[model samples]
Target chain A: MLMEKSAVENGFIIDLSSIKNTSQLVFELSSIMEHPDVKGKNICLKLGSLDLKQSQLLSIKALIESMNAKIAFIDTKSEQTEASAVSLGIMIKEISSDLTADIAPSEEDFKDSEYKEEAVEERTENPVQDTNSQEIVEVHTEVHNNPIETTEGIEDIYDEVSAQELSEVIPSENYQPDGFGILAASEGLLPEETSKYILLDTGNVLPEGVEENSVNTESMQTLYINQTLRSGQTISYDGNVFIIGDAHPGSEIIAGGDITVWGILGGIAHAGCNGNITSKVRALKLNAIQLRIAGLYARRNDTLNVPYVQKTNEFTPEEALIEDGKIVIYKKLRRD
Target chain B: MTGRVIVITSGKGGVGKTTTSANIGTALAKSGYKVVLIDTDLGLRNLDLLLGLENRIVYTIVDVIEERCKLRQALVKDKKNPNLQLLAAAQTRDKTAVNAEQLKEICDTLKEENDFVLVDCPAGIEQGFQNAVAGASEAIVVTTPEMSAIRDADRIIGLLATKEEITSVKLLLNRVRPNLIKSNEMMSVDDVVGILEIPLVGIIPEDAGIITSTNKGEPIVNDENALAGKAYRNVAERILGEEVPFLDLDEPKGFMAKIKNAIAKLKVKV
Candidate 1:
């Protein structure tokens, strides 16, 4: 039941002397540490041959903390004397006892001979020493061959039981690849992929609803707009926009759902940008630059049409639809 | 017959909004039209004082809305003009005492009883201004020849264009001095209209009588003998669909004795 874990831990010896965009490089490195599979493993980033900026070092430390891993950066460019001074601290703590035992031999040999004699006498009287000696030999052989093999055997048992439990807990459609994440887009930017749904999905060629170039209002998602959008600003969402106030002209608004304006809407709005065909844009006042839905576009002010010299005052708030493969404007039926 | 309401406003303050409202109301009433002037300035109620009807205000617009009095009881009859009335704003309360819907309700009731309901709006484009424009079908932008006033007038016109579909929006240029315009020291009426890009309603020349009338709590329109007052009456007649000759601001004034004396008085006041 355990899937093949693609654990690829590669080391990079990045020459800081050759890299110019250090900040961008550090950001990419942080993304590497945040990779879903190897994120929890211990990572050692060895820094070399350069003076890293304060911001760059701080960001590296922050990335290490986020992954909950250990990092050891080897600075290889320091003076030899200074390098040896750091090594001196490591030698005193780790090598002092080993060096003394290797050098002071006769006194240590006399103590070791008595200890061996006591161990031999105890082994002769107790059968537990025989079993303990055999177990120690097996443990030493496993350590030399592959220490992680035992951990893998235990992991296989837990993986099968957990997979069975998880299958019952979650719906099949909710499952996605581990690396899947949400992409955030800014104003005027389009998403890489768009989704669309029909108003009436009959089993026939012709859609039950003949409405075209309109938002698929049955699946409208409401988006709350809290700011006064100025002229020349464009806002698009995969959901309807609820503007608290006016939307100025020279601005473009596109939504995959319905668009509502509590105040005036003097800007262009394209509902059902993903071709939902039933979404509608509503506002207190609608004097926009253009209107579009699905494959329909209301290109009224274009100069290609000769002598349709309509002033801005002549335009009124009217709904748009596609009729006979041509976009047209219609007067909204008055509620009164 | 419900009267069509119109609110006179400018985004910038002190560009003669109240003066235009008082004069236009007076001119409308002088032509035998039933005109009701509603001061929507709240605590800073100045229309009553300008119209010379402050002492006759027994109840304010707030008093009627609060059920302390009837709408009829709150209307202050103009002292000299029988056709003119004033709905004075409450001096004790701020603008929050009423909102756009409440003001709209009041104007709806008043429209049934009057020929024209002129709402004197506050200066800034805020709640007070919104209350003034509520239930109104038309707008009158008042501005001077100065750059700041013209800019604010453009912004107010832009806001009105966004809010509702208005049929007629005209600009009334006030406090214009013809001599300064002739000398090229001030913006001409055409200049103000060209920048704001709106239709010109009327042009009011600089007359010392306007200041004197404000000081005495009298509308300049009361003086039918005055030139600026006649200009206001012309604007009112135009509003009523009557074609009238515009004032010949470019024409040389006659060397008559009366104009000479008036010019001397204007200079002395200055």
Candidate 2:
């Protein structure tokens, strides 16, 4: 015996308990539509266990339409079946009413509805037109549905909608809502203690001469000398300087950053001219007549008491640093 | 043969630049090369005195530059070595008597006939020094082992590094006392070479014979038995592309051996 049929709102439901293929489903749907009570009415094919391809669903939809009756597929979880049904002007009935109600019209849903309305309007306006215009309409509808083919297309739609909503939601000129803006805003959103900790962690927050420091550090280069800087020879650089040989008494070295001498330094060494107090002057034998770090200076007499005892009165390596507003000379540690 | 013009200069006075020039020129002449020594000191020429050609100078380099005499006429022949000659400086004329261009012209003309032209530069880095160095293609900086002399030598080396035609600059450490160097009282040859940062051409030991040789108006290079003479000869041979080891001035002498023997006897008695 054939499977029993049931009644639904404005439609008849034909159970596919015994149907195995598209031909059998079509036969059962045709018989149900042929009934006088169901003739010219909408029908819902309730799937039991049968799974059908898009082509099969489309053919069944066409057959039901030829009998002057509308057709739809109930309990269809496959998206391809639903797409083919929609392309053939067939309806899809959701298995649960709550699920149908939960999916309210989103922005993309509204766009799809508008696109369908435009497609219907064009179809009705150009009915019985030439094949060329028919193909043009098909191309137009394909272009409209092109985004539904890939996952990136869905993200593109979401991004466009969120960008538009952001422009409308945030009325402040300072509050930009793009990725970079969000990143910048996050820094401001952090708590005061947290921001302070981050600043300390980076160790880039220098003192008052930040502009000069950054400019000097960015463009500064090192000058290397492999030979001695004799008396009456002066070398001035905008950055760190290194000399591999002795600097005699009358020689002079001026730099913006640290100055390092691998040999004796008995001349005048001036470093940190860009107001960087942290810059230092290091030498194998630091006996400079005058040493200047930033604006502070130290003469030879001022450094005479600094004990640089290495191998009993021989020249010991020393480093000069600006500390507490005065230049201080100290014996350089082994690691330094 | 085109000759190499070498300038012998010591930035400080009395560092034996004239003596080094005369000895090197004489040694080269003794090796059968025609070498002419030019005194660029102008008013204070001493190369003639060191070369024992002081009484024979009828025309000075100043007269040659002034167009008063031909360069060949101003060149005085060495009585001891015919291949060696001396172009003395004018005692009355100052350093301004000849400029750098005039000296270079004279050197270029002299180099055509001579195998070597050694210019004895004046003391300071003034016009005289400039006139001496302007004609040379190579430089030999003579310096004593004193700190003051080494400082001046360093300055001169720095200046010579700026010259385009000076392809080589070598150092000659003069009057190095090995005993004093061992006691750390005087600078060693290494100390001067370290500060000057120039290749060492020679090291002349502090010998008492140098004083007698200078007083007798004879270059010490003519004294074959003298230690300073052998040092100058080695320097000349090295300048002529011959490799000669430096003399071991710190070798155990008779006095050191005597002291060592006395110490050994005292140790035995103890």
Q: lDDT of each model, Cα atoms only?
A: 0.59, 0.65
Clashing pairs in 1: A214-A277, A214-A278, A215-A277, A215-A278, A215-A279, A216-A278, A216-A279, A217-A278
The complex in candidate 2 yields a DockQ of: 0.00
lDDT of 2 by residue, B1-270 (tens): 799999999899999998899899999999999999999887666777676555345557887877767788788888679999999887656898889999999899899999999999999999999999998999999999988998899999999999999999999999888999999999888878888888999999877667656655678898766778889999999999988999999762332222122110000000
Model 1 CA deviation exceeding 4 Å by range: A1-336, B250-270
Q: Which 10 residues in a row give candidate 1 chain B its minimum summed lDDT?
A: B261-270
Interface RMSD of 1: 41.7
Tens-digit per-residue lDDT, B1-270, candidate 1: 878788899889998889999999988988888999999998777897687654345468888888877798788788678789999987657799999988999999998989999999999999998899887888999999999999999988988987673556889998888889989999988888889988778888777667656755678787756678878988998899888877976653322222222110000000
**Candidate maximizing lDDT:** 2
Angstrom error at residue A291, model 2:
64
lDDT of 2 at A262: 88
